[model samples]
Target: MANSLLKHPDFMRLWSAQIGSAFGSRITRTVLPIIAILLIDADPNEIAILSALSFAPGLIVAFFAGGFIDRNQKRPLLIVTDLVRAALIFSIPLAAFFGSITMMQLYIVAALVGAATALFQIADNAYLPRLVEKDQLVEANSKLESTDAVAEAAGPGIAGLLVSLVTAPVAMMVDGFTYLWSALMLTRIKKQEPEKQARDENDNLLSDAIAGLKACTNHPVVGPILAAETLLAFFGGTYLTLYMIVGLRTIGLDPFTLGVIISLGGVGGFLGAMAAAPMAQKLGLRTTLLITLALGQLSNFFIPLAAAMPEFGAAFLALQQIAGDIFMTIFVIQALSLRQRVMDENLLARANATFQLTTGIAVTISALLAGPLTIIFGIAPVLWGAAIGSMLALPIMWLAKEEKAA
Candidate 1:
């Protein structure tokens, strides 16, 4: 039987770290684009490039990092990466203070932070199995994601407020501080991590990355879900690259109202996190996954629709945030639990790396394409195409045979 996450101090520390990190991520997501639009007067192409830079490094490095993560302890990597991200974020505000912050600097920061986040996430996925019994993964993930959901709920609003009051670049200082907080919380964990097994002398990053990629593709359940997720990731990139521009510039919502609309997603995410396990229990994991995945993809239509109707933009966006986040959160929780339950502990990091690699590639391509597509066809059609592309994931997922959770 799984122990209560509420009673686990080390898990709580991990969860707390996630809280700060999640909030920091949310703020960065909000402010970076706004800074590009408002401060730098960048066009859609530049915004798309900014978005692409964030995921491009992960596409390049995550597979190798996954290999490295499996050969080392995760805790130190987690801490160091957090510090690095904090430093990177702090550099932005410092530059802004001197009135020298530029789109190139923002691009560099986003890329570096993306690479660090890729490492942190892979290590985190592998580390979790070591921290708790296999049976506890769902609950543990639920707790962690719930914290993220709370941050998601409030982070953007706080970011918007800070941006409104202090300006966008200076507002990034809050994200830097959150990373420092994350690092501090991580230091408080007392759990002794299991030592990595000694690798063969012939083993290297390339071989390990290849092995990871093979493992994920050869697995029955993992392979299909990975494909589906890659498709969704591509479509998701398109939405993200355009959403801020569409809202702030196209539909003309103020930053605070935009933040509030986005925060509704966090509220929905919290509800989804809380409901994931229960829904899995009641509906079975397969059914719940299908329902949520379909709903999540379908919900994205609202964005393009919102752009088409500026008068009702806020209402459409709010609905999109709430319904879309709820479904996506539920899908993510159940999907992650399913992956963790099935993969061997030693291979988990590599498998996750492979997953990240594919999705990162997809996202990068989508982000790069989104701007060009928008320039050619305009915002509404590009978004409509993205929404249509995202729905393709449902059939791919539907074709995969479900595995009973261990």
Candidate 2:
């Protein structure tokens, strides 16, 4: 149904940039925690605050970001953000070289990078539709998601290895350079955009944003599924907030072993990404969506349950990660594909921003709540709470009705 992207030069340029950026993002995500726990000796709450700070910018910027992105050329924004992120991340290693690395500096970097990431995401999503034809959106999105899966598969392990060979802060330099790589790739893409609509000077502040929110919420399939994703984001944020502590402190996984266990998720994700198109064809997209959600949600139960049974050890935890990663891979690709297929290109950025707004808030709330809740009820109880929240939202998906991969 879609044109092959094999010969599409612009799409290839974008894809190559994505591959670099995805891996860089993952490496930074992996190494930052190591730097926090090992270098800065961050407590559970400190880590929580760090995460909240990184994700918080989305809450602040996502609301109006779509309107901003939709009104501009995407590639320039992408290039600028990539360059800024590269500079911000490089500060970690430079500070370490001067023996001045501090938690505050890391916080600044996270916040700045998060802001850049928010802008880049909105621009990137909006740009994709313009680069490819309507029917090719799936193939494009699928390839992109697959790149993310590949990044996930290799990122942590690579980070772990890099951290072991070099210092954790030095490992961050790898990510910093990759962003520059992404920017270079972006410069080579030659696509041009259609003119932006002329905005009235009297345009309401949130007219476009409100319209996007209304459209997403009113769509039966998009509405319910997006809600599920928001809830899952909450659960995911909480799970991650506790994952470092749980794995490093309680279950006792060294960084390398932890990285390996996490990498298994990437392996699962790779397979899941490979399966999306074929599975969508064999079993309707709706069925595939529902099934993957069920599996992903079910995987959440295992993490908290593993805490109760230490005898099962890291193997159970690995199982949890593998399930969560694979199902989430499929879910993400399909969801993006569905949204791109159904929504008008003009409104895509706003709709994405609207989705980002709720999900970003969910993550922020989870990060803010996770530390204190763990202090009170402990990690296991809070994790179980996350699982329950995800489960409660699952029934909402029943309201979503559609057929086919699109």
Candidate 3:
């Protein structure tokens, strides 16, 4: 009974908007790299730089963004970010029309889009609980995630086809348009949002933000998870930065085939999301997260090994694609649910922002490291490092037993 969040009109609107946006987002994800690789001949270093630029703003602004979000209306920010992203993404197509598109423009677009993504994610996650009952959080998340998996699974294939037909630039306009559609859907939803709490005129923004960080870092359950999550992001960042390079240059897959391979991963994520609740029930939430993290990190090792042996690279990457998504999805769902269960509702945005900030830092480090390391030792060694470094989080997880709160 608690699981039927979709029956609610507001949630349905959010989900509907999300469906189009998710698929469109995938087109943007796939096309950008395809443009860099197939169209403009971007080298490994350039691709790494593009990846770095994409998420850099999160590290810069995410720490304090939480306090600001908590003090204001969320829906407007979400709408504005969506529209801004639409404009930024559309600029690429506009420039291509005038024969003025450059790698520089792509870098700028990626950074701006990433910054918007950070804000949207924090605001959106905070907003969802307002739309449903507390008992339904996991179920709401699961439904959202499962449908998201479906869109992601389909997205790459659609993106591949679109890019094949119209080239990366023209095809990518679909993503820009989708953002506009998402904003339109946001406007259609009529749920009255909770009034924003007025901030104390004397409150220090940094201190308020730090309080959220303390909430996460001081909590028994979340503390270790935060540590593990950051490591996962860092190592995962390294893997992602090198992943396309190994796929295109090392194993030699075409764009469409590569897209198909990525879509196959969505199958694994879909299965994992469906299983997340049951797994939490059976293993206990904390244990479930530990197990998933271990498995996800384990799957990452096969990634580099696949590249090392080209004959098996495609097969290995395919397995990792599926396996990695499954483990990570389960880990993410349970871990986040734990936060919702424990954290104060008022602090939800800040807690989530704090959470994002740490991962952002990890991502920044990984991005910065990936370019130089891959340039020097090549993809295999760096991948090996990423796999080994992921294990550094296990000790933290092992000690993260649940304790009763005062």
Best by lDDT: 1
**Residue lDDT tens for model 1, 82-113:** 99999999998788788898999989998999
Displacement of the residue 348 alpha carbon in candidate 2, Å: 1.2
Query: Candidate 3 — which residues are off by over 4 angstroms?
Result: 33-50, 95-105, 167-169, 248-257, 370-381, 403-406
Q: Give all candidates' CA lDDT scores.
A: 0.86, 0.83, 0.81
- TM-scores for candidates 1 onward, in order: 0.87, 0.89, 0.87
lDDT of model number 1 = 0.86
lDDT of 1 at 300: 93
Alpha-carbon RMSD to native, per candidate:
3.1, 2.8, 3.3
lDDT of 3 by residue, 110-187 (tens): 888888878888888877777767666677777778877888898877887888898888887988988888888888
Clashing pairs in 2: none
